[model samples]
Structures are given as C-alpha cells and as structure tokens.
Target: MSKQVIALAYDGRNAPSVTAKGDDALAEAILAIAREHEVPIYENAELVRLLARLELGDAIPEALYRSIAEVIAFAWYLKGKAPVGFGQRDDGDAPLLLSGPER
Candidate 1:
C-alpha cells in the first residue's frame, strides 16, 4: 500500500474535522509539518485507510467516534492535558490508563 497521512482537529465542543490528507509525497509533507509543529503522531495503517476516505474539512462520521476518541485521548494524555473538570473534584479520582505504544 502507498504511504498515506491524515490530520484531524477537534474542538471540545464540536466533532473532529479532517484538516489534511495525502498520499506519497504529499503525505511526507503533511508529516513534516506535523513534526515541525510538535503535534502528536499516531500510526495506524487501518485507521489511515478509513480516514483517507474523508474530505478535507469534513467532520468525522459517527461510526468513527470511538476510534477517533481513543486517539485524541491518547494525544491529550501525552501532552499532560485533561478535559475541563476532569479529575478536578475529590470524588473524581479516576486514573487515566496509559498503555504501551501501538505498533
């Protein structure tokens, strides 16, 4: 399969949107920009195949909510960020489960 890359952006209040997508050389450029910006990179060939189907500026479909959420959550964890009010109260002491890197 040819190399591919997809980039997404999400605001807490709205669904995530596809900000970029490309194959081969364009894919390399996208990855380079992301690396320059220090954005987290997660590699999943299967997920890339699915996301590459989306148009630029398109919000992620409902069917992908869970998968996308997991990726976003992991990125947040890597950046040491938590959702607003998450684990803020004494009663909400749930620990975030960070797992081994996915291949």
Candidate 2:
C-alpha cells in the first residue's frame, strides 16, 4: 500500500503546517515551493528553539529565516513528507508534524 506522504509549512515561529501527497511527490512539491519563494529550509533542534520564541500574530523576524527553514524541513522529516511553505494542519497527521523530541 502506498503510504500517505505529506508536506508541511509554517511561519517559522508558530506551529507547523501540513499537507498530503501520494508519495514522495509531496516532499518534492514542498521543495519546489520553497525554492520558488526563496525561503530557506531547516531540520532539528535549532528549528525548535527558533519556533519557541515566536508568538502568534507577531511579525516574522528577518533573522529567523534560517530557523524557520529548519522548522519546515524538520516538520517534513517528522511526517515522512516534505516542506511546502507556511501553514498548519489539525488533522490526525497534525500531531506528527507538531511532535518534538520526547522530553
């Protein structure tokens, strides 16, 4: 069976956003979108720290570009999908993207 692949986006500060694709197609689509928008992408703990300091409705800081990228990339990896751009999802898949290292 084909596993549901997903794509994720975020404001680089708040929670992650997610989307679904049939397979790796979603991940590729996400990369393309990021490239088109000239947005950097990232993955790992650095992403978490950067996202932590952001507040909803606050303006995105210029310095946080890399961090935002990392968060988006990480979200993709976590969901076994790809980075799309900047948005969030609330479906069952949402938890997977929002999940961080178990503390």
How do the predictions measure up, each by TM-score?
A: 0.81, 0.32
For each candidate in turn, give its C-alpha RMSD to the true structure in angstroms.
7.1, 13.3
Question: For model 2, how does the per-residue alpha-carbon lDDT over 10-97 read when each residue is reduced to its tens digit?
Answer: 5434644443222245445545665575444443343444444545334336676565455545545655554344354432322222
After superposing all C-alphas onto the true structure, candidate 2 shows an RMSD in angstroms of 13.3
Off by over 4 Å in 2: 1-55, 84-103
- Quickly count the clashes in candidate 1: 0
Candidate 1 whole-model C-alpha lDDT, 0 to 1: 0.70
Residue 3 error for model 1, in Å? 1.3
The alpha-carbon deviation from the true structure for residue 35 of candidate 1, after best TM-score superposition, in angstroms, is 0.5
| Model 2 residue 76 lDDT score | 56
- For model 1, how does the per-residue alpha-carbon lDDT over 18-99 read when each residue is reduced to its tens digit? 8888887777777778778767788777877787788988988999999988988887777676677786322122111111
After TM-score superposition, the amount by which residue 56's alpha carbon in candidate 1 deviates from its true location, in angstroms, is 0.3
Model 1 lowest lDDT segment of ten: 91-100
